[model samples]
Target: MSDVHGRSSGTGRLVTVLAWALLLIGLWLWGRGVTGVPENPARPGTGDVAGLGTATVPLPPAAEPLGAAPPQRIDIPELGVQAPVMARGLDSRGAVDPPPFNRPDVVGWYGYGTAPGAAGAALMVGHVDTESRPAVFYKLSTLKPGETVRVVRADGRVAHFTIDDIRVLARDDFDAQQAYGPREPGRAELRLITCGGSFDRASRSYTANVVVSAYLTGTGP
Candidate 1:
């Protein structure tokens, strides 16, 4: 991936790989738990305590899941983001590949996972910064519950999700299930992820991850 100036940089590549590696480990653990594989005990602080179940604002009930369709774009009105969505596969290291660094305004969806409005959690990842400038999800941590996220699908339907939980999960104690797992059985869920917390210049990566959880509350043509 290219850097902010459209030139490939070693730092940019390192940051991208390290950031996605955090989720790769967590997602692997989550898959293990689902398949009846014995799992490692979670660390004491792995829970989403930063902003757990604190949505005092009432949210609408979840809508029924729609048929699978690829997402074409994503809109976060609260953050002033209207970015194209592209399917991303895992990198050689097994981490979910992110959007190219030059395209800082785009969002990457985990193409192998659940579709946005499907009956499971759809995973999306974006860059918080591109070494020099803020990226598509730079303001993701500031989002509050009850805000709206709209995903335009290829089937010509807009899946509107309502934000209900946000967390800054420390990398040392990250929990994949809590960050990416379904909040409620049979509800269409979405997870927007980006690097968060203070950047570690030494490691060229952030210390934590911002995960915004939402559920499908309505739809539009």
Candidate 2:
């Protein structure tokens, strides 16, 4: 089953995610000119923030793939984020597994692709907010470009990424090319995605998706 985006879709499975991504544009029109409401207000989280590359800083170059990975975990003390390991590969449904958004306990694996440290954008999608809780990505938008975001891969290696840019792009703008673009050799990049901009009550969605692009840096998990 291919998605409306011309990607694979198990209908029930990938459709919901594609809907959230695409419908965000409709939500934007509905909430025109509106910013996000304080749905789950908390202390402002911190990480490196870059604004379209104006304040650029040097980053560690991409390295060789670590090949097979050893067991590891991803932890973010700032947001109290901790999650177990899950390998993301193209599933039968053809859609990726979305990261756990509302709750911080579970982590999302990039459902449609490889386990990030492998090659392309280690795409990780988390819930900006679920019905019951403030998901792991509740504060993702707060991250600025050039800010450092780290990931501990299963292979006992840590890959650090310095954010390059943060964009509030419509679902229409999500291209597999950009969304899952190639990374530097041995360097692992990542993209954290979730609903952003404005949320709609009627459809229960957001106006846009916040995509944070980061370049690779650092060592083991």
Top lDDT: which candidate number?
1
Residue pairs that clash (backbone atoms under 3 angstroms), model 1: none
Worst 10 residues of 1 by lDDT: 34-43
The whole-model lDDT of each prediction reads: 0.73, 0.51
Q: How does each model score on TM-score?
A: 0.77, 0.63
**Scored by Cα lDDT, where does model 1 land?**
0.73
The candidate 2 region of ten consecutive residues with least summed lDDT is 43-52
Candidate with top TM-score is: 1
- Per-residue CA lDDT of model 2 for 181-202, tens digit only, reads 5434444567666566555565
Give the runs in model 1 whose Cα sits over 4 Å from its true position.
Answer: 1-53
Instruction: Please give the RMSD of candidate 1 to the true structure.
Output: 12.3
